[model samples]
Target: MKQRLEADKMDSAQTVSAFVQTTRDKVSVINNKLQRLLDGYLDQLIDQETYKQEKNKLVSSKKSLEENLLTLERTQTGWIEPFSKWIDQAENLPAVAECGTLLEQKSAAKLLFGSNLQLSASEASGTAQSPWDFLQETKNSFKNSEIFADCAILEPKVGLEPTTCGLRYRCSTR
Candidate 1:
């Protein structure tokens, strides 16, 4: 996963570099064309109207290219680091499940499940689409093991009586 992330980051960097270089080259070509247009107008080789029209077109293209280059430079390095951090943290879910507080666990569930979490009178469950789905599947295999017992439980109940968290409860009929 780390290798894949590094490869993805490298690919993104290369793509951005290529994009910026291409835009700079295009701006250079447009500047040359503008200079040639000015020379033609001065030498009376081209009429005023033709010069204005051609210059406007070249100037617009140059502005667009410059904007694209700026945008690419500013945003290209933004998402990769955060994304890599997320992947690193995601790999430690079991530890988080083992030691994290209830609030932390719920936050992790929110991150993993997004809007797929559901709460009702009997259950608080996240959809199976979570990246943790494999963990859920294997949990039953280790149910009897002391180290795995707590982590194996996925859903918590939503009950009429609230717990300290104010929403969840662990209850069974007497």
Candidate 2:
């Protein structure tokens, strides 16, 4: 599984690199087109109407490409680092939940289940499923498994003390 994850990460990195290069190339091409359009207008080779239309198109394309490049660069490893960190800290979740502060526990929950945290009376009722419901489902689905089966038992459901109910209330819906 680790090898597969590493391979997938490498594939994603390569894909992002290719996308960045493609966007750069497209921006360069559009820039060249804009320059040519300017030159044509300056030399009186193309009418003003034609120059305006082509220039507008080139500029729009260039702007879009540049924005895409910026987004790609910014997010290249944004998710990967967090995911890798989560994997690295997977074993520490129990410790974090057991000994860590309320804030740390919440932070770990957010990292594991994303930010769809909700605090309500129903969740504290214990009749309502915990946020780690998916882990339960996974464990149920793979009862004989050696990996996730253990993970299912790693952390007990966060207790519902009225004081800490507010803390346990912040759980991932999904």
Candidate 3:
């Protein structure tokens, strides 16, 4: 039975990995199209600078999508790693038109409360509130916001840096 369960989990992981790969391929194709469009505009084929600017946005969007696909693949494998991988990807992307990120939402909410938000592993052992509760509350906030409703990841606070004790909230108008 244990062997069967392990095999089932492995199969699930394989399925998720395949899905991630397919999603990555789609995002890559879109990114390539955007790149080509941008190149054409730069070469004066498109004529409108605005068109080039819009196409350039695909660079970051494609990158974030790729990162998210990778993160999902990791999650499907039963790993509970920190969300920094996705956050790092977003941070590296160019901020263009409105697009949201899940990591950003959690980080923004964490920032609003405090920066050093950490879910105590020991909480899982007792009747303490689950860490996900905080996230849920933050998600509620995102739904009601007028501007910068998308979530954003924040840089972890170091010694003497202004930080919150719980999840952080960072609202950006840009």
Candidate 4:
């Protein structure tokens, strides 16, 4: 599985690399043409009006190609490892919350809270990110609602087994 993942990553990068090469080649061609155009204008081989028009078109093309190349380069797969590590850490957050060490809890908090993490008054508090924040909002809304106030365990009417209740939530590897 690891080998396949590595191969897939390489394949994805290969496609981007191929396109980057093509774009670089196009840019090089444009630059060469531009230099020749300048030479023509300087040598009086081309009129000023014609030189200006051609230069404008080539400059526009070069700028666009450069921008595209920059974007493609920025999208490289260098972030995959760190993101996978983060996912692993995130999946273990429930365990961290349950019985992990203080350092582990701090790490988990920072992962969930991002830059909003704050340590004050002997307590940690912050705005959570994404699904966590959504989960908090859902929990608060439910806790404040009258419909679920008297209810703790949600029992099925006829068949299903009762599951553990409360706002207790856990993160899963999936």
Candidate 5:
């Protein structure tokens, strides 16, 4: 089950990377064309006014493209990859089956059923802290509830417990 979750996370990362790469490639092509256009204008092949207007457009487009590339890089490298790694390493807890609707326990139940689990936004900090610890902390935040769910065990940290005490709660709201 843990292996399957890891594989799913890997698949998501690949999909995100592929999309970012495609965007960057398209921007590169546009930037290249703009550079060539500016070069031709500067050589007096095009009139001064025409050259100025065209160059301005190209420069503006290049700036926006560069900004987009930076944003995508941050999203992919700075967030998704690290979060995926963390999720793969977080600890798992036992799931509790309650009478409430399944949607209430979707995330926790998914963990129990071996379905893919997505790390919550709280667990996605840019830091390199242990994922299992983060998940355990998150689970503890909701420990007052009645719904119980199972989580996977991430590799133990040095001098830490083999598995973290996450939760076993039942929620009344479905």
Candidate 6:
């Protein structure tokens, strides 16, 4: 996703830069024309009124193009803010899930699940919204899989062993 966004930004920056170059080329042409007009007036090849009128038009056009160049440059960087914000939030999510206070966890859950949270069958169930839904489905799919059979070994000890604790992990023939 980051790569995709970078590619998009590169493509747009190239387009904006191309336009700026074209505008600059036009300004260069206007400068040349203005210089020629002055030479023509000095050599009596054109009238003073005509030269003044032509110069004014070129100056006005050049100013407008310069302003547009500034605008294009300013707006090209606007994509960074949203991208940075997404990165920050995504990176912070796991930490919040693990150790953040109950309020923080609730806020994060609501952010991900929206109004889809539920307590069906006395189990926490929800349809995660949009992108997060895919991750939630992935987690659910792995919940019953035996591939990570050792994961429970890492669960922190919390209290005295319950009567059912030994019942869950029994030696069985494969």
RMSD of each: 15.2, 12.5, 20.8, 12.6, 16.9, 17.1
Worst 10 residues of 2 by lDDT: 165-174
> Model 4 over residues 52-74: C-alpha lDDT tens digits?
99999999999999999998898
- 69-106 in candidate 2: lDDT tens per residue? 99988887787776666456765777997999989987
**Candidate 6 residue pairs in backbone clash:** none
lDDT (CA) for every model shown?
0.75, 0.70, 0.57, 0.76, 0.56, 0.74
RMSD of 4: 12.6
In candidate 4, which residue pairs get closer than 3 Å at backbone N, Cα or C atoms, i.e. clash?
none
Cα lDDT of candidate 3 equals 0.57
With candidate 5 superimposed using the best TM-score fit, by how many Å does residue 164's alpha carbon deviate from the native? 33
For lDDT, candidate 5 versus 6, the one ahead is: 6
In Å, residue 124's CA in model 5 sits off its true spot by: 29
Candidate 5 CA-lDDT value:
0.56
CA lDDT, candidate 5, residue 66: 78
Worst 10 residues of 4 by lDDT: 165-174
Per-residue lDDT for 103 in model 5? 63
Q: Lowest summed-lDDT stretch of 10 residues in model 3?
A: 123-132
Off by over 4 Å in 4: 1-8, 78-82, 94-98, 106-174
Clashes of each: 0, 0, 19, 0, 19, 0
Q: What is the TM-score of candidate 3?
A: 0.39
Instruction: Give per-residue CA lDDT, model 3, range 112-153, as digits (tens).
Output: 334544557643122213344444455566666654333443
User: What TM-score does structure 5 among the candidates reach?
Assistant: 0.42
Q: How much does candidate 6 score in TM-score?
A: 0.55
